[model samples]
Target: MGSVQRAMRLLETVAAHERGAPAKQLARQAGLALPTTYHLLRTLVHEGYLRRDSGLFHLGDAAERLSRRVARQRRRSAVTETLAHWHDVIGAPLYCARYRDGEIEVVGVADSQENPAVGEWADFRATGHAHAIGQCLLSQLDEEARRDHLARHPVQSLTPYTVEDEGAFLRRLAAARHGEPVLERQEYALGTVCAAIPIRIGTIVATVAVSLPVHQADQLLPTAHRLQAEIGRAPGVLALSFSI
Candidate 1:
């Protein structure tokens, strides 16, 4: 364990130098003996953790891959925490979703026993035509992308309020104004209404949505507007590409 710690220390020292550093400088900085540093550097090069070029050591591909994995994990954790915070602030079930590689994915959801989330009785990906979250994400996509998605998942009446057919759904999507929340009334689930606002960050298509019971439908628009404003202030919540 002590040897591993020494090796990690050396690696960190090497990383501090953008142009790389020589063995003697690395040893002095890491407080390791000259001989110990040489031995550990040789082992690191062999294990693909470091690469030596012109007598200077630099981080290798393995170290870079590890860094990327840790960064992604941190971003995913932040997204989850943000969703839970928003759920408490909005007093409704909160959902965060995105369009990745032509598929709708619900990345994070926050709910509790009191204000429980809607049950996923049916698959969300295939039922994109019948929900505010899906419609909002689709609205952000270009014409070809939207048509391609509908081609794979044909429009169907999941409830009395769902769009009737592909043509009507296409028209509805076209008529939707940009930068406005997509609203649905018990279209995806019985006795539930939802509103979704796009979280437009570059090319990544994402949405932040909230759902309330049909009886409390009047709160949908105001709640959605609040969510939009909150999301705008903390754009980091969706600034990452956890999916694509």
Candidate 2:
């Protein structure tokens, strides 16, 4: 395979293995000969894409920095526009989120309507389990990737309404995979209801949703439909651009 392809494969291998794979194991998984794998890994390490700890390899600070940059870049003017559109149409707080590593991070938010309950800025490392954004993004992953992600970071209950059991969470994910939007009610915060639709690109990347208070959400079905329709029409524009 070409160097670029090999590098991508190596990254995937590293991502798939949670504990940081040994050099020999990474080489075997990447299908590269031992010597070539070692050389490629060394080069990657030098370039700040991979880090070596003791004898195992993991993503380096450079890789994390790049990921954050990409994620920030994904929050384009279009995303801001989308958030604004949702805010105006729904008349409630609207936010855009994307999944990174095993967590969901909020990259953009619009607050045309005031809600004392929801904060302007979301916690950076907050779990995705209690929101539609996270569920929709998780739905986009394949079975193996989904399993790997859940294995790395098991679902946590953030509220009384949150899915606290594995089977129920899997069922919800299955529904999301079938193109159903997940409605989370006071799962992340009391008195908040979130409706999320999978913003899909071709078949992989997902990024779209509008969260509002339950009363506000009740008035937002039409607006939400419009948002979902708009997102469906321009899935690639957001997914390809945002990637942290």
TM-scores of the models, in the order given:
0.92, 0.59
With candidate 2 superimposed using the best TM-score fit, by how many Å does residue 122's alpha carbon deviate from the native? 8.2
| CA lDDT, candidate 1, residue 142 | 85
Please give the lDDT score at residue 100 for candidate 1.
Answer: 92
Off by over 4 Å in 2: 1-75, 113-117, 120-126, 202-204, 232-240
Q: What is the lDDT for 84 in model 1?
A: 87
Per TM-score, the best of the predicted structures is: 1
lDDT of each: 0.91, 0.70
Q: Backbone clashes per model, in order?
A: 0, 3
Clashing pairs in 2: 71-244, 74-241, 74-242
TM-score of 2: 0.59
